[model samples]
Target: MYNSDSFYLIASWRKEECPLKLSELQSKFGWLLIPAAVLVLVAFYFLNPQEKPEENLQASLDLIQAEPPQQTETPTQNPAPTTLMVDIKGQVAKPGVYELPVDSRMTDAIDAAGGFLAAAEPKAINLAMKVVDEMVIYVPEIGEEAALPTAQPGAAAAGGAKEALVNLNTATDVELMTLPGIGPSKAEAIIAYRTDSGSFQKIEDLKNVTGIGDKTFEKLKDSITVN
Candidate 1:
């Protein structure tokens, strides 16, 4: 039923309507156009290949991570000597407290003290006697009478010239009781006193005991010793 004039009119109306619709879309979606453009640029930037890092930078990082820690060296110290103290007196070149190796003999002590004097009686003490801590070695002169006795119990003088003396510092309760006028009670008291006050400095210190007096000390003075 359409004629040529009708077709022309329809084409004109469609062209006008197309232009109006495009204008309406631009006005309503103007803000949406900016956001769409930003999205496209972001996508392009992310998809693009990035440049590789420098080879030297990666190598330096690996070197730092793979490196071993430095070690600190400790210095060694000199060990102290294992030794004992002994006292050498009478007829020796040097007479005083001296340090000697453990298990050293009487001759070793004498040698350490510069040997014996010309008048020293070598028979006064046993040269083979082992020296101990706080030990006292006395070398008497020739023709000199031995007054004090040996510190060790039942051990004779060097030439068996005198009796053995009791060591007050190391004597047991039974040994002390053997002394004249020293009963069991007195011996226990002496041990208790020495324990509280430490070793006796000299034989004369025995008089300092609670029950011992000058008379009792005199009886045992020649028989007792402290070394």
Candidate 2:
């Protein structure tokens, strides 16, 4: 029932309005897509399981504390006591060699030798003197003359007869020369040795002299004594 002009106007208006509405809907849908993408990323991050750095460190510390402590070892000490050999002779109930501690005194030696006899002279020797290795101790009889040079008793004479032994410490050079294997030169050497090195502490000490060796000491050992 309308004319050609009115129909053309209505078609043009509809075409323009349809294009504007489509553009507005596309802009709105693009904004919604951005928010939806952010939500998906957040969900993926929380879904995967992983240990925290602080938790891993604390677990390592706990494992170390659970182990047992180490034990420290203490060192052991076992020390042996020192000992010495002593010879006790003359006037005692028993006369023999005995083993004694290094700190043992003369009284201890007398006790080891069955104590002194009734005729023993205690004041003749120093009872408080510390005993030495291979030392000789002699207890003289009461009223007997104190032996010259030392408190120790004399050794038996070299001959078959039993006579008072020669005192090496007090004997003259001529007397020393009288012994076997000793000559004037050897006597002089012995006198010089005793003069330089005090009185001999033991018969073995004679071996320390010049020109005297183990073989020479072997021959003289039985003929000498040191108190």
Best-fitting candidate, scored by lDDT: 1
**Per-model C-alpha lDDT, please?**
0.73, 0.65
Each prediction's RMSD over C-alphas, in Å, is 13.2, 14.4
Q: Write candidate 2's Cα lDDT for 131-158 as tens digits.
A: 6666656566676434322223332211
TM-score of each: 0.35, 0.36
Position 53, candidate 2: lDDT: 98
Candidate with top TM-score is: 2
User: Relative to the unseen true structure, what is the C-alpha lDDT of residue 17 in candidate 1, on a scale of 0 to 100?
Assistant: 73
Tens digits of lDDT, candidate 1, 1-227: 99999999999999987766767888988879999999999999889956557877898899998999888998988887589877666678987789999888878989999998999888767888777666656676777544333355534332221245778889777667545456578888899989999999988888888988886675557668887
Clashing pairs in 1: none
Regions of candidate 2 where Cα sits further than 4 Å from its true position:
1-78, 82-84, 132-134, 141-227
